[model samples]
Target: MPVDQETTARDGDTPDDLGSVQYAQTAVVPMDPAHLERHRVVAHQKAHPASWAFDVLRTQVLQKMDESGWRTLAVTSPSVESGKTVVAINLAISIAQQTNRTALLVDFDLRRPSVARSLGLNRPKSLNDFLDGHASLAEALVNPGIERFVVLPTNRPVNSASELLSSAKVGKLIKDLRERYSDRIVIFDLPPVLAADDVMSVLPRIDCVLMVVGSGVSTQTEVEEAMNRLSKANMLGVILNKDESPTQNAYY
Candidate 1:
C-alpha cells in the first residue's frame, strides 16, 4: 500500500525527500551525523569510505533476497557483542539508499534492545509501547532523517520476550509489516540464537535469516550450534565482523 496521503515531512525530517512518503504519520527525528559517525553507522554517509563495504553487502543481500522472493529478513549472531545490530543498521541504510526501495529496521531483541541507542534515538513512543497496547505500529515508527528508511526501536527490555515473540500478536505484526507496503525491506534485528530462545521463537515467522559473527568473539561450538538451530531457516549468509585482518575496515 502507498503511504498515507496528506503525509508531509514533519519537523526535523530530512529535507532530502524522495518525492514520496514511506510513512505519513511516522515521527521524523533528525539523526545527528556526528553521533552516527561516533557509533560507526556510516552507510548513509556517501562521503565515508567505510560505506562502500556495506554497499557491496547490500547488493549481495538484495540479490539473494530478490532471487529467493523473500521479504522479511531476521539478523542475528552466535553470541552477544558480535556486532549483529551494527551490520543490520548499515545494511538497512544501504538498502534504503536504493531509489526503488524503502527499508524498515525493526528491533526485535526484546531482552536487550539497542537499536535506538545505536542510532542515537531518544523518543517517547517505541516498540515497547506498541507491544504494551499503548501505541499503534504507525506511532512507534521513526524516520531518523534518512529518506526511505524508518526504525521500529525498542526502548526497554521485556522479561517474557521468548513467549511474546512466539505469540499470535507478534506473528501478526511480522505478517502485517511484510505485506503492508511495496518495495519495502523489513529487517528484524533479533537476539542471538545462543543467547536465548527468542531467535528460534521468531525464526519461523520470518522469511529468511542472516547470521553475523565476530571473528574473535564467537566460539566454533557456538557458531556450529547456532547454524544447527537455523538449519531449517532460509539462510541469507553469514557476516564476518570485527576482524582486523582486513585492510582498514573489518566488518562485512
Candidate 2:
C-alpha cells in the first residue's frame, strides 16, 4: 500500500486542519467541555420509542457475545449509506452510558469515515495509519464530551484501505484495544460488506457482525449472498432499518 508522510504544522496552524499525513493514527485526545452537549444531542437523536428495540437487541448481542467470549464487534451493511455508522455510533453511545462501563468507537470505514465529523471532532488518524506504522494509537483516540467514551476517526481515505484492514496489524490493533480498555466496549464501524471484502476480512476478529439491512431496499437474495461469504454464522444477525411493520421496527 502507498504511504503518506506525517506533517505537523507551526503554532499558528489552522484549527480545522490536522496537518497532512500518509496514514491515520490513533491518539488520545483530551475531552473538550463542549463535547458534552454534542453527546447529549447524539444521544437524543438516537432516543426514540424505536430505540427500545435496540436496547433489547443490545441485551441479546451481549448475551450471545458473553457466551462466546467475544468483545470486539463490527457493525456493517450490504451497501453504502445504509445507516450502519449511525447504528454503530448510537449503540456504542448507549453502551457507554451504562454507568461504569466505557465504550470506544473505532471508525474502520477508511473509504468514507464520518464518525469523528458527526461528533464534531477533527478527523482522526485511522486504523490504517496505526497499522501502517504512520502513527501511534495514543495519537488517534479522542473524547467527544462523554465520560468513558472515545472515538478513533478515519482521517483520510487511502488507496489500499482493504489490504490495510486485512493486515495483521489491524488484528493486533483490535487485540490491543480490548486489553487496554478491558472496562470499555469496542465498536467498529466497518465498510459495507458488499462494497468490499473489508467487512468479511475483519468479521472473524469481532464477537459478532451486526448486518443492517435497509427496510424496503435490501432484498433477501442480497442478504443471503453476503451471509454465504461469511466464515462464521453464529456471530451474525440482521438489523432492519426503517421498516413499517410492527414486528420489523427500525431498531431490529
Candidate 3:
C-alpha cells in the first residue's frame, strides 16, 4: 500500500509555485500478528465470520456519511462495556479493507483509552502526548499493519478529560484530521455518553455520531437518556451489539 504524506510549511519556509509545502513526514509501523489475534481484532482476518458483520456495518456507515458529506464519526454508547471501542476499531478496519477509503481510528476516550490495547499496539506516542504538546499529529499516528488504515491511540487516562476534549486544541485537532484528506474517514472511539461529559464536549466537533448498545447491558432508561443527550447531534444510527438471539448474529 502506498502512504500519502501531507506536508505543511514551517516557520520561514516558502511554498512551491504549485503551493505545496514542505514538512516532516510519518510512516506506518507494523503490528504484531500474535498480539492482534489475542485481542480479537478480527476485521483484518477476512476468513472470520465476525469480519462480515463489520463489512456490512462499514457499507451502511459510509453510505450515510457520504450522503451527509460527513467525514468524522464518533462512536459512543450509553455506558461502559457497551463495546463501542470494538465497534469503532472493527468498523474502521472493515472500511479500509473493503474500500479504497482510508480509515483513521482515533482513541478519544481519554478517561479510559483502550483502542491501542484492543488493537494490541504498545505504548506508542499517542494523542495524550500530542495534546500535551509533546508530539506532532504525524508522530502520534500508527498504521496497525492494515492497508489504508491508521490509528491515533491514547495510551493512558488524562485528568479533566471533559475539559481537555472541550479545549481549543482538541477542536483544532479534530478539524485538521477531518479536513486533512477528502477520502479519509476519521472515526473517534469516544467514551460512553453517560460515563462522562467528555462525549458531550467533543460531540459538537464531530460530523456525526453512532451509538452502540450492548444487548442486555444498557437499560431502556439509559438508552433514552443517551438519546436525549445526543438529540442535538447528528446521529447516524444506533448499533445493537453482542446480540445472542438465535435468529441473528452477535452484532447488528
Predicted model with the maximum lDDT: 1
- The 10-residue segment with the lowest total lDDT in model 3: 15-24
Ranking by lDDT: 1, 3, 2
Alpha carbon lDDT of residue 191, candidate 1?
96
Summing lDDT over every window of 10 consecutive residues in candidate 2, give the lowest-scoring window: 1-10
- lDDT on C-alpha atoms for all candidate structures: 0.83, 0.64, 0.80
lDDT tens digits by residue: candidate 2, 42-148: 44235445455555666777767667766788888877766677678767766766536667889989888877766666644555565667865545656555556
Model 3 residue 119 lDDT? Answer: 79
Error of 3 at 211 (Å): 0.6
Poorly placed runs, candidate 2 (over 4 Å): 1-41, 44-53, 123-128, 231-233, 243-252
Over 73-114, each residue of candidate 1 has an lDDT whose tens digit, in order, gives 999999998888888999999998865688999999999998
Backbone-clash count (model 1): 0
How displaced is residue 158 in candidate 1, in Å? 0.7
TM-scores for all candidates: the values are: 0.88, 0.75, 0.88
Candidate 3, residue 219: the lDDT equals 98
Model 2: number of clashes? 13
Q: Name model 1 segments beyond 4 Å from true.
A: 1-23, 244-252
